[model samples]
Structures are given as C-alpha cells and as structure tokens.
Target: MSGSWRAGLLAEGVSITVTAKAYRLLRAILMTATEDDKMLSRNPCWIKGADNERTPERPILTLAQVFELADRMADRRFKAMILLTTFASLRWGEVIALRRKDLDLTARTVRVREQLLELEGGEMRLCPPKSRAGKRTISIPSAIIPALADHLKRFVDEAEDSFVFLGKRGAFLRGGNFRREAKWAEALKEMGLTGLHFHDLRHTGNTLAAQSGASLADLKARMGHDSDRAALIYQHATRDADQKIADALSARVKAERKKARKKDH
Candidate 1:
C-alpha cells in the first residue's frame, strides 16, 4: 500500500514537500489503525525517508552583505529591523511582535516574550513563542545598539506598549504587507542576492554566532532552539574559523614543547 501510494504521488508529480506531508499523514493514520483501533495485523506504511522533508540550503549573508542590505532599505524604519533581525537572530514573528518595553538599550538586550502570528484570515494575534526557549532575552550586539535606539526614537511611539516596528501609516505590520511595502524582492535583486528569504537573516545570524566559537549550549540559548539537533545544524564552521582553531592548537602544543625543553635544560 505504501509503494502504491508513493507511485501514485510520483505519477501525479506532487512536490517533495507535499509528498512528504501526505505520506506522513497516511503513515500516522495507518499506525493508529494498527495499534489503537486494532483493525490491522501489521502496518504497511514502512517507507524510509518518505516522511522526511529535505529543506533547501539557505544563503548565509556575510556581515558586509548584511550591512549592505540594511543600507539599501528605502524606508529608514526598516533599516534597523534588518540589522536587528540579523544580529539578534530574530524570527519574523518575534521581531514584529517586539514592543517598546521589550528592548533595553542600556542593557543591550531584546526580550522576546511573544510572537505575532498572522492567522488564515489576515488577522494578527499575539501568542506565546513556539517553544519555552523561544521566550528568551537575547543580548544585542553593541554595534547595532545605536541603530536600534535610533529606530525606537524615529519610528516607535513613546508608549511602552507601542509596537517597535509599525507600518508607514502607524498600522501593525503584517508579513505580506511588509514584503510589499519594503520592496523586499527588489532590494534583494539590487544587492545581487536573488532568492534570499527573510528567514535567511536569522540563519545568517545563527551561522555567525556558531562561527564565533560559541559552545553548543551557547548556540542553543542564543538561537532559542528547543533541540540540540537544530543547534548542531547551525554550527557550520568556516574555513577561516577552522584555520584559527588549528593555529591556536599548534601554538599551544609548541609552547608546551618549549616549556618541556627548558625544564630538561
């Protein structure tokens, strides 16, 4: 039955993602029937890797590229948004949900208490983060503190409950509206960064943090990921970073040898 289902989906030319989701749904139903309902002697949906969705590689922008992208924003308000998103590894939902009180410029931290979720009918709702770890306070990089402060002064209202990022007409910003108003696609084209998603900003930030010799625990805390596996995926060591580690190890070994020789003498 699993083989037939796979064959039928392939014949229909369904996307890999859709196929994987469909297969998982089918497997889940069959598993329930076999175990809970006792309708089947054994489950037939035993396809390996059929339920796994292979995510495409997201582009990791360099620090220079990140700055360049921010500079190209036509709306001055969005400049700080881009910078904060990259440096702080904030998801779109979390960043948009930021309130004036959530940020502490003096302390250089952004407290993520909730996220703004856009519902099916385009209604915006504030809900708790996807995971407990998501409700965290991230330490902001000092380099972007000035930019964040500037954004608050210029765009955000003085009220603590006021949204940190608002639309030009002082309305709540939605994901679809943000893309249209920000001219996100055009900006990417101008920077020669075609096919880059907004989420890639978070990915870039995570990659940068990992490259900074962040321990697994540190990465998990900063990224607000619930699982070690998710944090491990972000630990992409660059060639330069790897070289620095090798050089440091070599120096330590050489110093130890020199000390040993001096003691013998």
Candidate 2:
C-alpha cells in the first residue's frame, strides 16, 4: 500500500517533502491503530531518513545588509521592526505582537510574553509564544534603542497595552498584508536579496551570536529553541570561529616550543 501510494504521488508530481510528510502521518495513524488492536508489538513504519528531511539552507544577511534592507523600507515602523528581529533574534509573530508595555527603553530590554496569531479570515488571536523559551526577556542593542524610541514616539500609541506595530488603518499587521502594502518584495529586490524571508533575520542574528562565542545554552535561549539541534546549526554556521580556534591552538604550540628551546639553551 505504501509503495503504491509513493508511486501514485510520484506520478502526480508531488514534491518529495510533501510525500514524505503524508507517508509519515499515515504510518503513525496505522501504527497507533494496530497497537491498540494488539495486531503488532511495535510500529513498522520505519523508513530510513523519512523523518530527517532537509530543506534548503536559509539565506542570512550581514549586519550591514540588515540595516541596508531596513533603510530601504519606506515605512519607518518596518525599519525598527527589521532591526529588532535581526538584533534580538525575534520571530515574525513575536515582533508583530510587541506592545508598548513589552519594551523598557531605560533597561533596553524587550519582554516577549505573547504572540498575535493571524488566523484564517483575518481574525487575530493572542496566544503564548511557540515555546517556553520563546517567552524570554531579550536585551536590545544600543543602536536599536534610538530607532525603537523614535518609532514609539511617532508610530505607536501612547497607551502601554497598545500594539507597537500596526497597519496604516491601525489594524494588526498581517504577514500577507505587510508583504503587499509595505512593499517588502521591492525592498528585498533593491537590496539584491530577492528570495530572503524575514525569518532569515533571526537566523543571521543567531549565527552572529554563535560566532561571537555565545555558549550553547545562550544560543538556545536567545533563539528560543527548546532543543540542542537548532542551536547546533548556529554552531555549525560559525566556521570562521573554528578557524580562529585552530589558530589559537597553533599559537599556543609555538609559544610552548619557544619556551622549551629557551630553557634548554
């Protein structure tokens, strides 16, 4: 049955990723039913590498490129939004959900408490973050503070509970609406980053943090990842730091050899 389904999907030109997910889901359901019926001692849906799907590497922008992209954005609110996501490693939902009360300019911290989830039919719901780690307090860079302050002064409502970022109509900022009305695509095009997604800003920030010698725990906390696997991606991204480690080891060896030679003499 699995083989026939796979063949059918292939013939239908379904993507491997979609086929893999469908098979995985089907396997789980069948296995669970079989277990309940005492038809099998264990799940027999094991397909090698089925669960280890890999997507293409996400594009990451440098700090300069991030600022360039932000500057190119016509909306000043978006400029602050871009900077916060890149520097604070915030997700799109988290950034859009920010309220005046969440930010503390005096302490330069942003408290991530909840997210504004945009459901179908333009309905918005406020919910807790994606994970426990998602509800964290992140320190903003001093450079970002000025822009955030300016944004608050000009764009945000004076009330603490009011949303920090809103559409021109003062409605919740939906991803689709922002992409269309804010000219996000055009900004990317002007920056020569046509295919880059907004989430890549978080990726860039996490990679930069890892390269700056942040520990695994720190990376996990900053990226709001519940698992080590995601944090390890940033560790892998810091190949230049690996080179620096090699150079330091070589320098230590050279220093030890020189000391030994001098003592022998």
Candidate 3:
C-alpha cells in the first residue's frame, strides 16, 4: 500500500479525502524514519501528497503596524491596499481584483465581488469572491473615501473597470508578492513587530467592528463572510469584548444577589 498504488491514489486524479489520508500516513512515515536516522535528508512522501495535514496559522496585525506599513509603502497602490486591508478586512485577492467602479464614494462603501488568482506563469484574473455571500458591500469611513479619491486621481487609470491597485508594470499583483498573509509577514518584520500575519488584519478589522458595537449580522455584512457563524468566530477570536461581556454579566448577577440579601436583612 506504500508503493505505486498509494502514489497513484494520492495523485491529481485522487479524491481530496484520499489525498488528505495520504498526507497523514506520509507524515508518520517521515517522522519515524527521521527519528531513527538524524542525518536522513529525504522523505519519499513528496512523490504523492503534502507532508502534513495541518493548516498553517493565519497571521494578524495591530493598528499601529497597519499605519506603519501604509506610511512605509513606497508604491501608492500598495499603500492603498494596506489601508483597505486594515480597514475593510477584504481578502488580498478581493482587493487586487477590485475595480475603480466597485467603490461608491457617495455611500462610503466598497463592493467585494471578485477575487484574483495567480496562475502558472504570470497570468492572473478575477474570479468570483471566495463564496457567494462573499460578494457583499462594506462601509468605509469618510477618510477612506477621500483617500480613494486621491488614489484614483493619482494612480487609477484606463477605464472605470481598471484595477484600482495596478502593479507598477500595470497588472494584477501576484500572490507571491502579497495575499494578506505574506504582506503581514513583510509588514510585521518591517515595523519591528513579531508574530503577525496579513489575515490578522482581517481579524483586527473584525475586532474593531465588534468593539464598535456592530451586531453579528452587521459584522458578517462588513466582513463579507459566507455565514453568520464565520462572523461569530470573530466574536470568539476577540477576547476583550468577550471579557467585557463576562464582566457585565457578573456585575448584574452579583448586584441582584446583594440586593436580595439586603432585602432579607
């Protein structure tokens, strides 16, 4: 089972579940083999599936780091992206696929309707957003509205559908250059911060939305998430508000108990 059939079953024609299983078995084999031989330089699991089953942790950024990255960014398009990422929590694909027309300056909202993928070679183009519900609008502050205006005046060109954040050579930004995750890594390092990722910017935005008293429904809309559950995960991820909620609940219960004791007295 660990030979050609296993390799073929883990190949492109294999089901995702089978590939996932292969990854788990492959990990065990490599670990066992490596523990026995410290100098062992290779693992044959590369022939079929991935080395591990775990997803990498997504990163987050602080507000200060977001501001720092925006300030340090030399390219105007890149700077715009940093701000939008921090503010809107839009995925890197969504932002890079954005068109000038996707914004409504009057309403102070941006439509996240599409996502871009970097294919083999240098080709890139917009597909739909990650999910159907991922196509939604999110409000921006007036400050961002003006900033976008300035950006459009200075950077955007061609037509209304032209990419708002065109690379200097005028193409969709490659994911290797960015994708929220990679950019967060770059920005955190640049700003002298540690252990943050671009996806954390989305988390930061979710935390901000929650702190601003946005309802779960509202947060979902703002985040362009696919479900209420996904938005609620932010409420779970954000510790401060949950702590505040716990504190408030304890106060109410304690006060009631104290009042009851006083009445009996």
Give Cα-based local distance difference scores for all models: 0.85, 0.81, 0.69
Steric collisions counted per model: 0, 0, 4
> lDDT: which candidate is best?
1
Q: What is the TM-score of each candidate against the true structure?
A: 0.73, 0.73, 0.68
Runs of candidate 3 exceeding 4 Å displacement: 1-60, 120-122, 178-187, 239-265
Residue 71's lDDT in candidate 3 = 65
Residue 240 in candidate 2, Cα distance off native in Å: 6.2
lDDT by residue for model 2 (1-265), tens: 5666664553332445777888789888878778777676766666666544465577788889988988888777788888898899988788889999999999999889998886756689999998998899988889889899999999988999999988878998876677766688898888777657767788788988888888899989888879998898788768666988999999999999999999999
In model 2, the clashing pairs are none
What is candidate 1's lDDT per residue for 1-265, written digit by digit as tens?
8988775553332445788898999889999999999999998989888887895566889899999889888788899999999999988889999999999999999999999887766688999998999999999999999999899988888999999998888877876567778787788899888767777888899999888878889999888888998778766455456888999999999999999999999
Off-target runs (Cα >4 Å) in candidate 1 are 1-52, 236-265
TM-score of 2: 0.73
Misplaced by over 4 Å in model 2 are: 1-52, 239-241, 244-265
2 versus 3: better lDDT goes to? 2
